[model samples]
Target: MSVPPENLHPRSRLVHDALRAAGILGEIVVLPDAASTAALAAAALGIEVGAIANSLVFWSDDEPLLVMTSGAHRVDTAALAERLGRGRISRASVEQVREATGQAIGGVAPTGHPAPIVTVVDEDLAAFDQIWAAGGTPHTVFPLTYDELVRLTGGTVAKVD
Candidate 1:
């Protein structure tokens, strides 16, 4: 169900507020069931898995790298690193993810992080007119256009897989 900003989970509220501050009007929606995975989120939303923008955090050169990748594919760290001209990028540990994003592992959003993260938007996500992303929790999600996601995160568009 759609949740107004005041009624959102604390973490989700952060996302809601962030979205509002960024001039986004889409309200956060809570799923009846937790959708910790992209496949599950797609099933619940009745959308193609490719339309789900998976918020992934990767550790690169001792910094947090936020990758908004398409749910249908996996991130190729080696290629990504080479493309980004960075050192090896590895999946951040749960604790690291939490520390970097101030949110949990299962439902991290691209925005509302403790600090601005170097973000990458998967070019594949642009194929969808609308994309869904986690709203700071596994049971929450929000919708926006591909351009909005890029603007929200100030993410560099690139091929992630």
Candidate 2:
């Protein structure tokens, strides 16, 4: 059974409100189980794993970088840093993830953070007409198109892997 937006976790409600404010028509779908991983989310949604937009937070010179990568690919931090003209990119600590996104690692949404994060949307995700993204909680997700995601997060489109 899917949980309605009004019944969502507080964090998920924040994401729902953000989506509405942005004029996105999609509603958050709460999974029966926590879909923390892309594979898990794909299986739950009955969609291709590539359609899952994994929200990853990285540390670039002490700044937080949010990379929305396709589930079908693995992000190469070194290559990404070189492509972005950055020195190094490392996975953010759990604390940093929470502080930066105001959500847990496995449930970070592209928007609805305490502040705007520097985000990069994977170019490969544009191949999909619709994509699923985390909804501020492990058990919640939402759908949107690639263009909508880029606009929502104000992210740069790049080949993340």
Off by over 4 Å in 2: none
Q: Which tens-of-lDDT digit does each residue in 1-161 have in candidate 1?
A: 99778899899999998999999988899999999899999999999999999999999999999999999989999999999999999999999999999888779988888789999999999999999999999999999999999999999999999
* C-alpha positional error of residue 153 in candidate 1 after TM-score superposition, expressed in Å: 0.4
Per-residue lDDT of candidate 2, residues 1-161 (tens digit): 55777888999999999999999988899888999999999999999999999999999977999999999999999999999998799999999999999999789999889999999899999999999999998988999999999999999899988
TM-score of each: 0.98, 0.97
In candidate 2, list every pair of residues with a backbone clash. none
The alpha-carbon lDDT assigned to residue 50 of candidate 2 equals 100
What would the C-alpha RMSD of candidate 1 be, to one decimal place? 0.6
